[model samples]
Target: MGVVERTWSWLATGAHWSGPDGVWHRLGEHLFLTAVCLAISCAIALPVAVLLGHLGKGGALAVNISNAGRAVPTFAVLVLLLLSPLGTHGSWPTVIALVLFAIPPLLTNAYVGMREVDRDVVEAARGMGMTGRQLIARVELPLAFPLIVTGVRTAAVQVVATTTLAALPGGGGLGRIITAGFRLTDTAQVVAGAVLVAALALLVEGVLMLAERLFDPVRRRTGPVPG
Candidate 1:
């Protein structure tokens, strides 16, 4: 049988869809890791980026430091974490590694987005008696929203793809499926696991893109005016 047929047969097996080690369960684990890591990374990166952007000071240094982190491989980080005290605490090492992997883009995009906001607009808001908080809330954030969301979309997709690495440390996720298939020399199962991860990543990208367009203030403002 061809590899495609074999993979299809493997997928069609009902047993694969049921039980604790099933695709459904693995997908849930994968998504849970992705969600937690994404949320934590956002919480850590966005505020710092936005604050630096708002102040228009120290942003370049911060962005450079974050971008430097991108050079380090996440698997290497996970390995180091696994050798540390946190490794014994279930999924904490995996979560921390993934969060580190996710932060650079979030920081870079948000900081760049905020810095990119028009100076004139900021000045006008201030001229209109807007305080620092009001200017950021009403002007900067709204204007920077698209890039910020783009950063989120980028990070989320990256996290979804990278979460597979969690299986290395016995952390649950679709990576388990792939790792198990490797151990058993089951090429079909490995391919199926890869296909699933790729599909999930694409789905996340599409959903976030739709959301970006839906909530885009620029799109809303430039939309057709009533007659």
Candidate 2:
């Protein structure tokens, strides 16, 4: 049989979709890891980036540090993390590696977005008696919202793709499917697992793109203003 037909047959097998080791279960684990890592990374990166951007200080240094982090391979980090004390705790190493993988983009985009906000608009807001907090809340964040969301979208897609690596440490995820297939020499199953991950990443990107457009202030303003 052709590779495509074999993969389709594997996917059509009901047993593969129904057990503890099923696609549904693996997908759940993958999603959970993605959500947790993304949330933690965002929580850590965004505030620092925004604060630096607002202060107009240390942003270059911060971005440089994060960029240096990106130069290190995530798998290497995961392996080192797995060798540490945290490895005794289930999933913590995987989570930490993925969070580290996710932080640079979040930090870079948020900092750039905030720094890129129109200075004239900021000065105008300041002239209107806006305090630092008010300016950030009402002006900087809203203006920077699109790029910030873009960073999130980028990070989410990346995390979804990378979470497969979690299976290396016996952390259950779709990567398990691929790794299992490799062990058994089942090419069809490996392909199916890859297809599933790719599909999920595309789905996430599309949803976030729609959300970006919906929340875009410039787009909203350009649309017919409320009568």
Candidate 3:
């Protein structure tokens, strides 16, 4: 049978969807790792991006440094991390590597979004005696909301795809299914695993896109209200 047919058959197998090493368990592990890493990346990147973007000070330098991190390969970082003391901590190296990979887009998009808010509107808000905190909360952030959500969506999908790397370190994730298939020379299993990862990434992208539209403050304000 062709790889495609075998992959469909493999995915259809109920036995592969249950148990410790099954698809569901691996999917859960993949999601947990993505969530944790995305959360950590946001925590580390957002406040700094917001503050710098708000002040309009030191933002360029900070953004440049963060963007520079993108050139570093995540797998190399993971390997180096595994060779260090962190190697003993299950999943930390993987988590750390994913977090690092996720940060640049969040920081860059947020900073650019904030900086792109209408300067005239900001001046008008300031003219009305709006304080720094007030301007950020009431003006800049709401205006930048869509772009920030875009950054989040981008990061989430990237993390989902990348979390498969976790299996390389003997950590749990969908990648393990692929690696297992490789070890056993089962092309069908490998194809199924790849399909699962792609489906998950697309699922995340779709959900976040819906969220972006629903929660966009500008759109809500400008859009028609229900009668």
Residue pairs in clash, model 2:
none
In model 2, the Cα lDDT at residue 194 comes to: 86
lDDT value, residue 196 of candidate 2: 89
Sequence-dependent TM-score of model 3: 0.95
**Candidate 3 at residue 119, lDDT?**
100
| Weakest 10 consecutive residues of candidate 1 by summed lDDT | 218-227
Q: Which ten residues in a row have the lowest lDDT in candidate 2?
A: 218-227
True-structure lDDT of candidate 1: 0.90
- lDDT by residue for model 2 (45-76), tens: 99998999999988777678767976898777
In candidate 3, what are the lDDT values of residues 1-227, reduced to their tens digit? 89889999999999999999899999999999999999999999889888989999877676786668777876778789999999999889899988988888898889889999999999999999999999999999999898888998998998887788778767789999999999999999999999999999999999999999899998898895667
Candidate 1: list runs displaced more than 4 Å: 224-227
- The C-alpha TM-scores of every prediction are 0.95, 0.95, 0.95
Give the Å shift of residue 10 in candidate 2: 0.6
How accurate locally, in lDDT, is each candidate? 0.90, 0.90, 0.90
Q: What lDDT tens digits, residue by residue, belong to model 1 across residues 134-172?
A: 988999999999999999999999999889988876788
